[model samples]
Target chain A: MSNAERPDGWAITSPRSDRVRMIASLSGRSARRKLGMFRAEGPQAVRSLLEHRAADVRELYLTDAGTAANPDLLALAAAAGRRIRRIPEDVLRAMVRSGNDAPAGATGSGADGPVSPQGVLALAAMPEPGLDDVLEGLPHGPLTLLVLHEVQDPGNVGTLIRAADASGAAAVIATAGTADVWAPKTVRSAAGSLFHLPVVTGIDPERLLPALAEHSISALATSGYAAQDLYDAELPERSAWLLGNEGHGLPDAVLQAADLAVRIPLAGSAESLNVAIAATVCLFETMRRRGGGAAR
Target chain B: MSNAERPDGWAITSPRSDRVRMIASLSGRSARRKLGMFRAEGPQAVRSLLEHRAADVRELYLTDAGTAANPDLLALAAAAGRRIRRIPEDVLRAMVRSGNDAPAGATGSGADGPVSPQGVLALAAMPEPGLDDVLEGLPHGPLTLLVLHEVQDPGNVGTLIRAADASGAAAVIATAGTADVWAPKTVRSAAGSLFHLPVVTGIDPERLLPALAEHSISALATSGYAAQDLYDAELPERSAWLLGNEGHGLPDAVLQAADLAVRIPLAGSAESLNVAIAATVCLFETMRRRGGGAAR
Candidate 1:
């Protein structure tokens, strides 16, 4: 398509341009809601979006260095028929708050910022899959789902998503008061796992409980002080693990609603594990129990 | 003693002062090496230093608000006979590169800086506990130790320390090329767990392997491609789990030196787990095997 005909074909050079401002504003909830779009920065995240959810990617922006370094990703984006725009490094830097100058070769993981300027970024349509849609599309047998309640830290939210994906969880549900999973930091920390499965956000636990029951998914709330140890609990074949906020943990009402309340036993001086770590331990334990063969 | 007579009793008011420069410079390797000291920032880290290693706390600085909020820590410092000085918040901010204006009540955990200025900071002597000393001081019965080889992120290092503490690991040893465990960010991420266990730095694996052999601690190196799954491996009563850098697995030599190589079996599309999360899984598995009761 000719540059004039393509909607996203403008070469963005000015950091102060409206397009840059709009892309940068994806960090905020209102901006994401108004724009109906969110950003995935660096090669890994952008590549994952293009690879898994190509139809959702609206535009791809690349600098000379980013293009040179990510030829395969460019090819994938082209195959997926995404509009590509060339952007300057300064413009790319302005699109994110921190780590804009990270080395181009970095894997976009374990770095300082949520969005590293790895020379490439993408503006993707928010895939607001409905809870019923996700429930209807569940994989055949022994399903694992993760429910995040009031987990406010973006890094923790992202890490949990990545962990959930790694543990073979079918989908993730973020209840009200949770951090925005579409936030740049959350996208980066997820390390591209966000695109791997269905994620439903802005959910209410009250509505979710009955829906989960309809789906035959037992909700297990994780608590630090629960009398039932994690190992002793018989995790169901179809389970939804409820992880809570880092500081206050699951509210008493939510704990009461869960089919079972389980705790990861602590053996040392640390009072508790980081929520993400705790979630991974629980998810993997469930995976292990369902004959996923991780233990073998 | 009078303020003039006390070696560390100077009230710092200027951010540009030499004392502030020295404290700020602790972020650098050469500065830490030359001064033989590192910084512990925020109230939790500072309080831990005073409580556990009072002799290592050379000096403590606190703002009026900090002193007021942390009365117990102040009394502990006084009881430990460490030098204490009062400073302005601006002066405290000048001592750290970031989060100088963090709210006085914030836990100083999620602020936008490597080091959060919690109105309190301390310069503590680097307690380079000898390998023999750590071995001799090990708690009776089965022991767990964490050995970090070349892991370069300060946050990861700190989280690993906290995880190690939570898993009941007796101590942690950071090999060369690893992020400095004494760095301010590491201290903050550790959340005072550094005080709960002995940490040894700059130890060569060649020497450590022999020392571990002498102590009958089996070395288990973690890798992503290992044929032996973590769940199936027989964890020894006394074990040293070696975790490598974020980007790279353990060096071939280090992996070869290990008594056994094991991998955490991942079931999803995630190629690998975060190093801290991986370490936690391995450490807890070891705990589970040694009757630490995580699985019981």
Candidate 2:
């Protein structure tokens, strides 16, 4: 919900006004870059940001006329010490992105578009995922990682991240040129997985992959036409799953740079799979291998 | 696509007229149901209908300019022995649905929306799918089958069917009240899979599963909540994959009807997997088992 003015304290009212027309225009990558801020909507999204970094949050909004008076959101906001602003009901309706439209074509009435609700839409600083090294020796969790490269669609990016979360991946690396996972739609499509997983953005694997040569992590990139079948590859104890553009798939440059390039075998007449579907297949395949008793 | 009409012929030009008004209100499922027709836009989608006898043959339109020049489409229309009506250009633009709207989090200038192309919108009769007895003896091939029980999302239905085509599934069966797999969005999302796959709709599993049983085809439903894991399940020598509703999964009635309800194990935070994902996992797992080795 961009377009809201920043009132002095933590409260925001009637957000998404023409006053913040810049934020709406910031739907462009160029604009998001200019502001160093992006938008995220819905109760779940706002709550995820609060749980992670309350200090980074600036303003919060709730609908006037007792819209978001529910105890759960209130408890979360109160616990985070975030003040709430009262906005007109109509104000909150326009704050959502279109894909939030009806759950990806769930129904005919287009209920997935933005809904009017009394909820908190907050502004939080972008996450700092730190260096790649942050994942090293992270307890006893599954040693999984999602490496993204120049993926263009925010929905696919978000969905991929969501799959990664479901499959227990530890982090996502958004190489330069990929959609920003924090951009509102990607964040929303991710269904709050953005906060659950560590995301490293603006990476140039041209430079980053070389630095990990010493680690035991197997660097595998997904390609539709790769020579090595995904099921046959010797998966690493810990992994780095590299994905690239939806149509182009992995660039030869990146594929050559990776430790190995693997592909999910197909049995159909269709040319290729959707970017998100491909990512999920690769991510879950790794998970299957690990749980099936592959000695990691 | 809707306004233009010429029953029993192939489309020629990419017309922009007439069909524009028809699709706006016809955007939802109820409207489509009332009309007894659905929208089909884009060259890929148009080509698909020409290729398949799966649906009833009906009206076809093409822009005068795009009609005369595109020999390949002309050849296809001729092969199908259908007539083509040409329309205006402006009407064509308004008819195409704009998909690929940047999802919520991505900061991008453009958003994907509904696609209703003006070039060639067909008013085709929905196909009456294969009966239980007709499908009992599936022809020889890779032999993949999609079974749905009340899957509500037309888009997901469309997408899964498209994936079935891409992954090479042989036929798709939709249980009672699931989204019409042949509806415009499902057709569009399917990326022409309906042409290649025998989509048997209005399928009541009580009648069909038993038929499949008589044919010695094991029917396995994908269950994230089930006790038997997919990797561990003994997939059939020949089988059908059953996918359930997006909200409530396959009914216990149907699950009990199935020879086995196999679970797709998850190691991550998602309490449940999407129906499409779960189905794809089940299908691929079948392929894995068919490849001659037990999966770990």
Candidate 3:
């Protein structure tokens, strides 16, 4: 709201103060798709880019005050041989959506002409598709991959990413129907996984299956009432854990394409697990098989 | 917002629409201080209440049309033995905070309110604490009580409670600083755990220490850089798991008060685990110790 005063190298004053645009456009996968980039706010996200050496980063935008508040963010971009741009509050506020409402009106990534310009947003390349990499790309043998089939909530998608990242999964592959992992909320919910790991979105399961079959892996889908528990099954090393849409879950077609459906064990009366938690159970089970459970 | 024909009952309306003396007092714990009560609007929160069987469900206020669309809600309340009331739509819309910028004295739950109230809400009672069963006389056997200190996110609080419930721990105690497990968001996140189990808020660790000392269960604090990994530690049956705040983590006093500080192993660059996830890892570890791992 006030006139911006930033560092020497960056220009702080706005050319048009009253007529600022907010980029809530990052809310939609399509919008993200058009621009080939997404929004990243907060100190954690900024630090993640530095930690992972994110290859897609074209710009590092921040508030001059944000730079003053979060020196770690400044250190991050600087250490990575990147510059931090001091952006406007109106732009940042426009791009960011609080937990108040799920972002809406995602017509396309670049469909609209400058919907909003936030304090900091990036134009980065989409993570490349490598389904085979998901199956066998880790340092050890038989890596695990989390395959999300139309899981709609960005928060759920992001949480799953965070959990998957924590378990040291090979990668996360999202079908075209799943919520965009790069959406601002999903990215925020993912904490920093988006920066540290591979997140391939907008592919069809039809296209993904053959590549997975080539890797000699099994796709284990999670069902609410299936008899066996996720931990009960003899989890394999090269396994793809699939979590479906929230209400309908995976359609018959998606499940028919997978190896088997497993259930997370429930002792109580919960009709279901949150999609993120369900995915986490599946992922950790694989990690457990991979000796992630062994003492450090 | 249209009104549906109401049955021969009292005035059917939206509580949010009735612009009366609304207490937007979220400043301290006082407004929330009154246990067994809070406000929320949204499809998800309402659905969670229907599922949870919370006992103090004092009233069900709704516009006649809301009742028609979500008849399941009516059936659920009846099944739960709750009372329902219906109101007008214009009144209800007026009750809602239209935009994020809800001015004080607007008589609505906005910004902090849940998104989308389907013309209905229920005032439910916070379940009676189950400390009576767990700490009835401070048993001599091994006991593990989990304590959450100032975890601010309502969802995180709820998830932690779910983890506590899932692990079958004796009870979950919250310090004065922790988030409210009974808040609508927390309840939704807990997935009805609040009804089936005990989440005691506003307690002093000092009070619990003396109470549990009889059981000889030492406190195990968790920190990112602790000396030992939780998986490798020799956990006792009578231990207490202490998890701290999300942003700031556990305060110094809470950690210092603990018998030991342990860390979950991390092989990846994730800065930290979700507090709830970290607690689950620890609880499941304990469950495994108690030989529940054989269930798999």
lDDT of 3: 0.63
Q: What TM-score does structure 2 among the candidates reach?
A: 0.76
Fraction of reference contacts reproduced per prediction? 0.39, 0.30, 0.14
lDDT: which candidate is best?
1
In terms of DockQ, which candidate is strongest?
Answer: 1
Q: What is the TM-score of chain A in candidate 2?
A: 0.80
lDDT of 1 by residue, B1-296 (tens): 22236544449778888888878778666778899998899887888788888988888888877877888876787689876788888888778753222222222114234544567889988888888899877766688899999998887898899889877888999897788888777887787888888899988888999899888899998887788888888888788999998777789999999998987877777767778878877887777566555311
**Candidate 2's residue-wise lDDT over B1-296, tens digit each?**
22235533333233333445565445555656777666666666777778765235575657765665555666777677776665566555544433232222232212234543535666676665566544755775345678888887666787788766655566788887787775666776677777666788786678888878777777888766678888876666667888888768988888888888877776655446667677766666666556612211
Candidate 3 chain B weakest ten by summed lDDT: B19-28
- Across A117-215, the per-residue lDDT of candidate 3 in tens digits comes to 223454455566565554455444567778888888776787788887887776788998987677666776788887777777777898887777777
Candidate 1 lDDT over A1-296, as tens digits, reads 22225444448768888878778777677878999999898888988898889999988888878978988876787688776787778888888742222222222124444435589899999999999999998966688999999998887898899889878898999998899899877887798889988999999999998999998999998877788888777888889999999768889999999998887877776766778878888888887676554311
TM-score of each: 0.85, 0.76, 0.80
Candidate 1 local distance difference test against the native: 0.80
Clashes of each: 0, 49, 26
Output the better candidate (2/3) by lDDT.
2
Please list the C-alpha lDDT of all candidates, in the order they appear.
0.80, 0.65, 0.63
Regions of model 1 farther than 4 Å from truth: A1-10, A13-17, A86-91, A97-110, A139-141, A293-296, B1-21, B62-71, B78-88, B98-111, B114-120, B136-141, B293-296
**Which 10 consecutive residues of model 2 chain B have the lowest summed lDDT?**
B102-111
Estimate, for each residue in B144-216, the C-alpha lDDT of model 3 and write its tens digit: 5788887887767877777666666667788877776655456656755666555677877667666656557
